[model samples]
Target: MVETTRRYVLAKRPEGKPDRDTFELEETGVSDPRHGEVLVRTLYLSVDPYMRGRMRDRESYAEPWDVGDPMQGGVVGEVVESEHERWSEGDRVVGNLYWSEYAVVDGDDLSRVDARAENVTLSSYLGVLGMPGRTAYFGTLEVAEPDPGETVVVSGAAGAVGSTVGQIAKLAGARVVGFAGSDEKVEFLEDDLGFDAGINYKTTDDYRAALDDAAPDGVDAYFDNVGGPITDAVFTRLNVDARVAICGQIALYNEEGVPTGPRKLPQLIATRAKVEGLLVRDFSPRFREATEQLHEWVANGDVEYRESVVEGFENAPDAFLGLFEGENIGKQVVKVAEPSE
Candidate 1:
């Protein structure tokens, strides 16, 4: 009997926040792997804020997804069938694959996972040891460049990339402050992640004042994950020669038109600040190095991670939609299926 696969496809372009209508689920038969290919059974699928931009019809850093096409993201899976020299049956791997239960992919597109790694989970490859980890690694240490005793601020502090950025800043000896949406997230940042302060942005009426209270020395580095009012406030507190890494602009992702916010160029000019937008793919050549360091940090408990998993492949769309709702803490991933022994 031929194996079947279930997947989610883009139904419509979202004008604002996406709804259930934005995705359509489909069922299809999986094709046998050709030479130099493998048939993978997805174990976990990553849901990230950046996927929202890809839903639009326009081009950006990543190609836009076409309507009625299967959605794609980071997936960790087990090879159930293989016709490739480098991969074999039962081998666990990670790659950019469709939001499906199974997919046939080229051998070169998949990276083998080390099942022997101590205390590592398969989902870790989609979160802390994957794209988000690499993004935080280079964005903070390379782009933001926070120094010891300097104040570093991260927006969207509880999410995947932001959480890692704040913790990495702490490791660099910088005083880290984070802005999150809820009291629980604030607690996680300050108490769990060792941030100097975590402001509940939802409850704060005056963002600038709240940021001022948190960073009395002014922000020396800003790792911006959610841009808008929170970012506008952080710019006001930038110290001389401040560095800003624009990792994500989740606040504006769902907007119909370009979202407007407070003018920040004047502040940048006055502070002589440097701001650079970062994409993890830009540092692809050094992914192994970053992954190695992140794995070490995670293994030694020097860096901690949290995941908000939505169980079942059927709920993958729900998991993706939840990103704008702030439904996740460290990383949001969907558990598709259990690996076969």
Candidate 2:
């Protein structure tokens, strides 16, 4: 059995965008699981934009990571040793585990993954069938609630959550428009994901004009993942009684100070738009329901997903930093190790 583990720790709080120096890799002795716990060997780790919030000294939906402490996020792993009856050796599971190669976690904190399930990969548990998927399902369907024939625009449309939101809106019989960072992402949204229109925000000189040209009927629902000038443009085109789901604000996640942008409340008031922030954890009680539906959608070809996987555990920090750079078309994950099966 492996006796040592390598983990990434928060070295310092990032002022604006986090760099490689923000994380420090440390090697430590692996400990055996005590009663009601299991030793997990990480197979894959998720790198999300939300983790940036944790890098700050302030509090948010996720607790701030203290400097010198191990950074944590969703991890899919195999149970190498178990002191809990519910878990056995070689069992595949997923949980909010540390960035280490191995971790001693309580059985209750982990959810068993059925590796035998058809078409399901271990990495999918950290992405499409996991938190990002759940966030898209609830945020679009529950928060945005786009009615049939309505025009729904999604910011960050090539991303994990944003892509899912656009597809869900399309499934609900609404016209879906998307704004992505690159031309290739715009193509993916339009050609592969069945979005009605896709705009390359990187290429567009006028966001409002591009949006107006695509969504002539106006945006009845907006699923915002990146909040910045693009979002400001979206606010201008909102139709009456529009619904906006504020799922993420990736655009401002790295700013050293609060960025001042165009005031949008006046537009919201004029349009009577309702904007509500979303956190997937709030829908935890219905996770199974969402997961089952998402699984079905993926299985039946009703939904599609992509993954940008970094090859090694050592590259986890790089994969995370890539989020702000829009390097991934969908979910960004680090392949730590293969399952022991």
**Residue 64 deviation, candidate 2, in Å?**
0.5
Best by lDDT: 2
Q: Taking the tens digit of each residue's C-alpha lDDT, what string does model 2 give over 213-311?
A: 999999999999999999999999999999999999999998888789988899988899999999889999999999999888887778888899999
Q: What are the TM-scores, per candidate, against the unseen true structure? A: 0.98, 0.98
User: For each predicted model, how many residue pairs clash, with residues at least 3 apart or on different chains?
Assistant: 0, 0
Per-residue lDDT of 126-231 in model 1, one digit per residue for the tens? 9989999999999999999988999999999999988999999999999999999999999999899899999999999999999879998899999999988999
lDDT score for residue 223 of model 1: 96
Query: Model 2 Cα displacement at 171 (Å)?
Result: 1.0
